[model samples]
Target: MAKKWFLAANKKQTDGNRMEAPQRINASDGINTSASLETLPHVLFADDDANMREYVSCLLKTQYRVTVVQNGIMALELAKTTRPDLILSDIIMPGMDGIQLLQALRQDPRTHDIPLILLSIRASEASKIDSFDAGADDYLVKPFTPPELLARIKAHITLKRTRNQAYQAIKSSEELLQSVFNGVPSSIAVYKTCYAADNSIDDFEMFLLNDLMCQSLNRPKHDIIGKRYRELFPTASKLDVLDLFKEVVYTGQSTSFERWYETNGKNRCLRFKANKLHDLLIVIADDMTAEKQLQIKNEQMKAKQLEMEARQQREIFRVTLRTQEEERRRISENLHNGLGQMLFSIKLNLDTIDLSDSLFSTEENRKKLKNAELLLANCIRESRRISHELMPSILEDFGLEAAIENICSQLTGPCNFVAEIEPIVPPADQEIQLAVYRIVQELALNIVKHSQATEASIKIYDSNEGFINATVSDNGIGFDIQKEDNNATGLLTIKHRVKMLRGNIHCSSQIGIGTAIKISLPKTIDTY
Candidate 1:
């Protein structure tokens, strides 16, 4: 006969006193149980015998919060819901016995970590072996002492709790690392170095690529990861990008540089930094194509603006030359017509008076008439000279060459001025012809007044390069051309006229030596 098991339960005594049931603390309530209650781990007990279930639950409740079930099936279901710290199930039951329950619980991630112990009346080695093979943490025989059962439960529960805490810490650390990796804006990649048979690093295999790197490459993570550098970007072999990775790995130093690549029918400029971590290489890259393009555009705009400004300045100079030429023509006409006519009429009226005739026939009257005629003649010559100086009609009628020769013949100075003019046709543009003639005239005057030289020469010739070149030289006391004051209006006017003709002038002079001025003007001006 089997022994009947008796266990304590809540009941009323004959003296009307109530027996207290063991306290049931709900671990999920988050209640701050006493230190003794906090130490009480939750346990699930399963058995086919009602008496045995009651007997064990009563004893285990003193040390642990106990939940009892009728069979292994009930025990497995309750274990999943409560996620108890430990499970104790009978080896033999009507269905889904202890070994089967252990296998099912171990297969589930939720209950696999819960420490399990097997209890049965069959203490055979085969039964024990089956319990351990099915993933039992501990096994015990029937009618075991309460102390032994409590000790085993405590040990396994402590171990399980320790492992759970360690797993949580590692999960938190991984989450933090993932956040940092995704937060960076630049494209980043990590590669593991691969070597050739000769032990030299030949290539690299991708270990990790951040989201930005995938987007930059226009490839998915699955396609990029575990791919060789050259395989993913065949063009990289031509660019020798793998060399950069090898250098970083071998030297244990970081390097940065700019590179250009053509992708998807567009050019991209990237600034890259490469560093090595043992056998792995880390690369960070930023796209700089937009920045470079903007800089190039700005430079183009500046050049265009400078060109426009130069055109405007030339236009202003052309208008000024036209106005000056018109004013000179007006002054020349006034001097030649109005003033010359008046002087000529005065001379004719004087000539009409007969000093030799009767009225006086005195020596003093004849001498006075002769003096008056000389004064009128001088006035008439002065008027004509002023008109010619204001605007040389010879320049317009006979061209630049004839005008130069005429001016040279009319020089009334100690300087022996000579002209070696080339008989080229005058420029088609009247403005150009006038500018060249005026520049030469100013140069000749400067030589006469400032250069106390005995000999001066002017040469005008056609250069082979579609330009007319003129040079003026004098053997005289040359002044410092650099130190010449702004008040030197004659030289300044010469420079201004040359500029108007789109010509260039160079003046060289030294004290006690000689002065030479060279001018070159293009034959045709660009009107556009």
Candidate 2:
């Protein structure tokens, strides 16, 4: 397997004259690293030699943005943040060297899969093997011709793109698995777990799924519940998979892999993983058997769908739904589990203390009583905030407009709240209302949190699609939407929920100017 390498790009793609490849010091091919259909191909190049970085940059500039770092420390730092499509590094330098950098990257999930291409003057067979053992995606001999290096790059890049495209095609081919719960048609051993009320994964009721999951392992989920990845999959030899999972969990990045193994004594490869929509792991597997044949019609349909919508919108929708559910669960639990208990205790104390008793009668006792009452009031306010954040209780009592009005008034930012709800939105469905409110809430939070502007506006007007349009705008510094990092998980969640409401969310932002989010959603019947 080629060691994961990464490339850095400033723009989506470069445009210029296609210069011949620069003379190379070293390069190698990768086996386990490449781009996926769901993610764009990114890359990073590192070298202490400014001339070399520039030369390589000039040669690859048309295809990739060449990041020139003074040393490996900078490379590692940039790699964590940029997560380029590929990594091209130099073998020797001050502070951190390529070998050390590669080792660190291997240990970090964010950079592990990036195809790493090493460059240096001391190129030998032994050195090449050492590079491979250390996990270089490709190794090129020093003083090598530009043509040869480019050929190798082309081959490795080509192989990776091919593999990912095949995996995506397979996934699209099997989209009918969209039916939730009855079965995924995919090889998922789901039994039942005590799913959290907020739908976040509190604990997997492994006992129920024990039989199904362990049927593959001959071991139960109990043994694997808190177990490490290496214990679960002896085949996961690369540290990258372990490192990757941690990064995914910590940073909320979605990663996928294709695993090939023998099932039923037959060799098969599975569309192993997909974006983490919620607590559930989305996976797909198909048999490569002669008897288990797929119809030509089905294949045609899969290919067509893959070519068409690809359900990228659905992916976004699922992520948003899962995020909202998770957020609600967290906030509710904080209230119910934390503030709720405290408030209950305070209420009990109040009830137990008789107003007619001596403790309540004295002038000093009265002051003490008044202070206790104030403390209890604060706790009540905290609980109310938590509940409102979760699912404004008022939204149910009154309609969406009144609830939103209350929310706007409570918003602590300096911006004044202004709203226009015609006929007061005519009581849209619960899901639709929640979606709109949540979107508005998140937008408001962003303004309070990031946008350093003074005032903003909110309007809910009817659109031609028989849906309402909610617009939020501010005069804050805007960011490049395309440049938003994959680590911007919050934005992804927002995008997802908008999709769930069968709505369209469009954002227009300009640096030093301002930002605007226009949400157009169809009105659905109430979920509550």
lDDT (CA) for every model shown?
A: 0.78, 0.65
Cα lDDT of model 1 by residue, 236-336, tens digit = 77885778878889999899988888866678888889999878998888889999899889999989999986886675576557647856786677766
Per-residue CA lDDT of candidate 2, range 1-528, in tens? 011111222111243324333333232322112332124345567877666666666666444445678788999999999877667788888999999999999999877776788877766789999999999888876655556766776677777678768878866654443234225344453212233488643322221222334465567556755544344565555434444444444456767665565544655454444334344433233333432335556788788888665577667656757776877787788878777776776666565555664754565555656766876887878877775766688888887788767767777567665666665345466777787887788788778778787777778777655677888888877778887582263667777667655678888889999888888877754421
Clashes (backbone N, CA, C under 3 Å), per candidate, total 0, 37
Name the candidate that leads on TM-score.
1
> Where does candidate 2 stray beyond 4 Å?
1-298, 301-365, 424-427, 486-489, 525-528
List clashing residue pairs in candidate 1: none
What TM-score goes with each of the models?
Answer: 0.41, 0.37
Superposed by TM-score, candidate 2 places the C-alpha of residue 402 at a distance from the truth, in angstroms, of 1.9
On the 0 to 100 scale, the lDDT of residue 425 in model 1 is 56
| lDDT at position 252, candidate 2 | 64
